[model samples]
Target: METRKSYFFVGVGGSGMMPLAMILAGRGDQVAGSDRALDSGALPAKFADLTAKSVALFPQDGSGISSADQIVVASAAVEATVPDIVAAEAVGAARLSRAELLSQLFNAGVLPIGVAGTSGKSTVTGMIGWILHACGRDPTVMNGAVMKNFVAPQAPFASALVGQGEAFVSEVDESDGSIALYHPKIAVLNNVSLDHKSLEELRALFGTFAGRAVTTVVNVGDAESAALAMSLPRDRLVTFAIDASADLRAENLLPEPFAIGFDLVKGGERHKVRLSVPGRHNVSNALAALGAVRAAGVPLAEAITAIAGFVGLKRRFELVGEAGGVAVIDDFGHNPDKIAATLETLHAFPGRLLVLFQPHGYGPLKVMRRELVAMFAERLAAGDVLVLPDPVYQGGTVNREVTSADIVAEIAATGAQAAHIADRAGAAAHLVALARPGDRIVVMGARDDTLSLLAGDMLGQLS
Candidate 1:
């Protein structure tokens, strides 16, 4: 009864774009895309997964944009000079930003849940999606990271789940100021911090996002989010916290190497929850998910039970393997807050951390270089080692003023063991060489999926 549409994604290999393509293709839409990564054959596995879904893939030289009826969806980062954009313009094809298309689909849902934050967006989105799916709600979930719980042979990259249900759960990005576009019935704000934008801009964007929702789930442990929660009507706010008292609270914390357990308290009821993922940060993430689903009419007890089954997202403190008493972990700790949380969680145990952090981009290094240096200087133990690689730049015209060497120099001045190796492979080799028995080698960064492969290679070398 519905007419199928055609969409051509410019950067189809992107974390955000890939999932949207999958969701569209799964829904019986004609989906095709082009990516520089595909043409270069960098991530063959990712492109193969797309092809397995019957989604056509092409090189980035504008060969995919065939007709005027096709909608060209691209991220804000796509410059007008891109071949896809040039082809689309020449063909008179309709164009939409990734956020515009996602919001268009999200806003049409009967019950839309938009999860927004500086960090933990993917984890919380995956949690809410898993809980709904486990509880048989059949939610349509869109995430930037692949959910381990949803991964199957056919759906190798199960970041987006297209379901025939009313509830649609998606993580809304605030980096490009697109969080304002989504109209969510239930909004979840995990925490507010300086990531892609300044605190002032983030505050205004996040405040309006939460205020528009019929019910809002907020983390009171974060000062900025707590302040925003106070500004919203109390009746519509559902608060969660680990250190601070709130409507949904996680107490009696227990941290382990591969898992964490805590007692979740809501009203007069309390229940123990154990997640396969490690860290106090994940406990906070779980509370946010519980609060969100609870606001969506899922019972507290049911949400807790379903959340306990959550494994976690790939690259979110994922342990690749343990060999010769050394563990290699892959994490998506790009920003200051995310890196701090990863450092804190890793520091909770007794092993020395050999952290190889690749900055996500030169632009972010310009913004948070000082904070990153400060976090590393404060968080790294006396014997711990930190290695830095030049940020990931995928052929873009960006200011390279703030290099990783500057960050390492600043951190070294604070008496921390820091080194900058312009090459990521050299950085990883350095970390591996510094790794000792009982030490955990963490490959941390974002915007690059090869970090996981690097972690695997480190594990292989260790073995």
Candidate 2:
């Protein structure tokens, strides 16, 4: 019998941390955690959800660690100087990185599916989880974002679903090289691109990840992922793409304002796939999910049928509401690829974009500064407006070399209407003021969940 363990997470409110905490608490483990966000009183609903699950929440001031038997889990971003960490050290509690603990839990599953990529991992994980559940697999799914399909009145934040079945589905992160920690029965590679790591580093990490899996599901539509797929053993690989020949192919693509339709072709059999989520990127995500569940032994047709009901994650191009002929959207598009995809999806329609993008953090801004500027400069249409605030800073010290102002200036050099507001609310106010009829106001960022509230506020004001 597995003994119940007591665990405390230092950054419990984080996108990655929250789901793991939920999974642990769901399994009858003693779970407690603290977050900088909780201290600042941000995103109360999330904390409330955790509290409702019997997971204790605390201030980041080290009060949560009362016993030495408690295991402290912290993300890589948490410094040793954090009050929680300092407290845990003083209490002689064992410590583990979030990835270390998640990998341990995930690897222990009878069947583990690790979804990896620069983008769409969360969406694809949600799709596969939904499909597996619909097919009666009853998978335990861990994701970074809330799966709308799983959201219930009692469970508003449905990022983690605990089940008794053998299958464990989770999106694995490569940002901290933690993708290497998970050994999955089914590894789904949505795409390999420059996000947190270099292309070279990404290729190596993704290659080894694919190599370790019993069956690798890859997207041939992405150049980097396609190259990775080509290198893997053919017998262990299942590939998918958009408008190209692969094990699973999506053709006859059609984009709607809030949904998409595609023809999924697998093994010379054709089936129409309609996703409640919009964008070509999601079609690729659907293909990757189909490939993954298919590799997991689910019938492709049944998987396709289940996937059509996927409503997508909460912040991935989520339409907040339309008011006074202006549509407001909330999205988690921090990286260049994700931002570009959102821009492309919105541009497919007729509205001019009024974008307010908050960089997730200073570190990512420094890493992808050039690519971000280039993406915004090229993707923002002539009439579109872009606003940015300073990157999210919870507490830790970071290099301030790359600021939002720098990005805005570089993008403005290309004649795009860009501004740096330095405050999120001010930036959002600017976007709301600039938004007009026949325009779409988009709030894009990550790490911080308050952006959704900002979008809703904008919608209310527009009304």
In model 1, which regions exceed 4 Å deviation?
A: 1-3
Question: Runs in model 2 with CA error above 4 Å?
Answer: none
lDDT for each residue of candidate 2 in 1-463, tens digit (9 for 90 to 100): 1548999999888889999999999999999999888888888899999999999998889999989999999988899888889999899999999999999999999999999999999999999999999999999999999999999999999999999898899999999999999999999999988888899999999999889999999998899899888888899999999988899899999999999999888786889889999999999999889888888889988998899899999999998999989999999999999999999999999989999999988889989999999998889998999999999887767889989999999999999999999988888888888888999999999988888899999999899
Error of 2 at 390 (Å): 0.9
Residue-by-residue lDDT tens digits, candidate 1, 314-335: 9999889999889998999998
lDDT of candidate model 1 versus the reference: 0.91
Listed in order, each prediction's TM-score against the native is 0.98, 0.98
Model 2 steric clash total:
0
Task: In candidate 2, list every pair of residues with a backbone clash.
Answer: none
